[model samples]
Target: MLFKKTATFITAIMLSFAALFTPFPSHAEAHATNSYQSLENTINAILSDASIKSAMTSVTVRKASTGEIVYEANADRKVTPASTLKLLTAAAALETLGEDYRFTTDVLTDGTISNGVLNGNLYLRGQGDPTLMKKELDQFAATLSKLGVKKINGDLVGDDQWFDNIRLSPSIDKSDETYYYAAQISALTLSPNADYDAGTVIVDAKPTKKGYKPKISVTPDEGIVTIVNKANTVAKGKRNTLSIKRQHGTNKIMVSGNIPVGSSKREWVTVSNPTAHTLAIFKSSLSSKGIKFSSTSKNVRRQAPDTAKVLAVHKSMPLKNLMIPFMKLSNNTHAEILAKTMGKKVYGEGSWNAGLRVMHEYATSIGLDASEWHFEDASGMSHKNKVSSAQLTELLLLVRNAPWYGSFVKSLPISGIDNRFVGGTLRNRLASPSVKGKVIAKTGSLNNVKSLAGYAETKSGETLVFTILTQDHKDSTLPSIDKIATAITTTPIY
Candidate 1:
């Protein structure tokens, strides 16, 4: 089946070349009038702006149906892709796991249940489902209650062996441990809310009495997180500034700042130990359901015993359903989870090294030259990752023929759309009516890197795939990138 599809793709590419070299009468006339040359000059003017003269820029546009290059400028020069790398990860996931793949979280026990007591330890085994919620944990607790297990004689163990023990990527910035974007990745993790942000919690600070310390609270209120508040509420109109940080090697969050009277501040902070946080939340949920544990919960690195019996289970929505949030919000955790999961599924080892190997193999098999791109991490958060505009466009064209292509494209952020989740990272971008809703792409941004890549509908009703990567520019280059997209989307029929 794979070979048959590959042949089809190869044949399509050949046909595109045949058409490009054999121009129609009208196209010949347009060439005589220098239409293509005129467009090239216009695009080159934008790319050569003085502000971005020193930066590395890679741009490529190709006709989706024909696989013919329409425009190119340093397209083969490698540049950091940032979040746009998610496109590669997402495509690999669809191929490896399929659209119907689902993750399951299970409750198991190694002890026998007699009368109203469980004589041994209760194990919570996680399958690395990123969408697990407090409500689902509540359901697990309810199940225990229904089973008449009121007490656990042994420890409440959190089994996170589904993946390796590594939590945060070493390449990520280590100074700010509280930033939710850099949250830890764990097999057993908990997201505070529907944003599906795992390994983090929300901290809200509100003023209490004038000249006194402000009160702090965390949402979903079940996880165990300690907040050391040293903030004060000052007189009205006073400057409001707040600082929130999680101490190294512990789950202690320090919040120090001043908020004017009647003002409130909020932030989403990462948790130091996500396994402990999950266990804490589960234990609390069990307590609310009238269940108790004799000892504190602990992390269990090993797999559950064979003698263990199943108590309750929760399965996540299919992979196809998750693509929307995963891609729309540019969720780093999702990318990492999928990468590790792919590694585990294909090689029986759930590490980044193993997963990235599979990703490279897949990309190469689909016509993207392996030498043209290098990926260090699935989320593109690593500065070591590099890919050329030509490679990204080749990937886009190859995947357009895949069975899951529609869902994959829909997962991208649409340009000019006003909807938050729908518009995603591109919601406010390309707002001009001429371009709005005409382009769908993935966005990438780092300290001084910006990238956008995906599909654009040209005025002639042809679909074009494009990629724009700009790095180390001192000024904003988004406007220039937008103009490039506009040209591709508005390309004349000829």
Candidate 2:
């Protein structure tokens, strides 16, 4: 159901001394006026545009220092927040796991090494580390090589018991199975690149001689995926339309379409079975080290026997360092991995329900009203998630004073920045001289939902925490949203 709340204005507020640097008239003279009507008018005018006539929007702005409600409209209503929900997840992770936490991937064996002919299963275990790459797994193989005994007489096993078997959320669309952004989660998984996109691979198609089939390759060059090429090379001036997709429930990727003779294209496709993907990569890495195992006959799930010996382990970068790519790029896999890790840490289980419970408990402890929000998954990919603007702003205010605030804020994508590492999704947004570098917020977008929430530093140097969510808007609502953000920064202090 759609809902809206009339704008609320809190008056008789003492002017903040930080207003000295404000671009408006002198602070004292502006204080004499004692009203935020102009700012409200500017924001309202943008919202009243014909493009959002039927859209439901909620906005709330509060003084970061005093928690004063500077302006609010429908702030109490619940709305889908898209990726902006990462703000809450990131904060919860920092608080629950601490900034120094790390994820570890280990290699072990159930049998002893003897005379180069040990006869037992070699198990690869994971702790839901999203950043596991081929290089790290190769290091494990190298360590095994240095251990002196190398012939395995049993099937290679993958142990993913750290988390439940449910790899993908039930609510996620089945059609998205091939998209890397909606990759499956596993305690043991392979990321295609350093971006840490777990459970996915990069498919590269390059044009060959005209009239010949295009050459196809997959990154990390693992034999895990089966590529079926139906693509053709066309004349240099022909259209370069191409389509790459993984068949449902399998790792059979179909590459089709025309590629101009000199062109090349790439697609990041999700792997159907994350465990198998990890095992394959590890096996490949092992063979590269001249270490050969007895059989590729069977790859199954099993626990590392108590007698198993530790071979080698790879520890991920600290959680604080991971926050940059996770938050900056809005990585869904990282979010899910951290959620399960939290569950494992707090409840001895690594399921979403248990992890979300920990996050919920943390939220309540921090003073957010329970009725104001609900978390369906750590990542905001699920549409079932809902949160009120007031809840977001309040949470923002609370975290600003937390011990981990420094790392958390640095993780956020900054505005007006062109570098992907710096600007993230907001790099090109809000670039106006007055707004650029002045606002640091998270951006969320889905079918018809758009949300922006975070802190904005005004010309007066007053820090304001705000959230703006628009639902059911068909037309591009970013400009209007940008206007609202700009309004908050330029709004005179009265």
Model 2 regions lying over 4 Å from their true place: 1-35
Q: Which residue runs of candidate 1 sit more than 4 Å off their true CA positions?
A: 1-35, 295-301, 491-493
- Which candidate has the highest lDDT of all? 1
TM-score of each: 0.91, 0.91
Per-residue CA lDDT of model 2 for 108-197, tens digit only, reads 887778877657788999998888898898888888888875677888899999998878765579988899888999999888887889
**lDDT per residue, candidate 1, 431-455, as tens digits?**
7867776778999988888899998
Candidates in order: C-alpha RMSD to true structure: 7.2, 7.6
Backbone clashes in each candidate structure, one number apiece? Answer: 0, 0
What TM-score would candidate 2 get against the native? 0.91
Q: Give the whole-model CA lDDT for all candidates, comma-separated.
A: 0.82, 0.81
Clashing pairs in 2: none
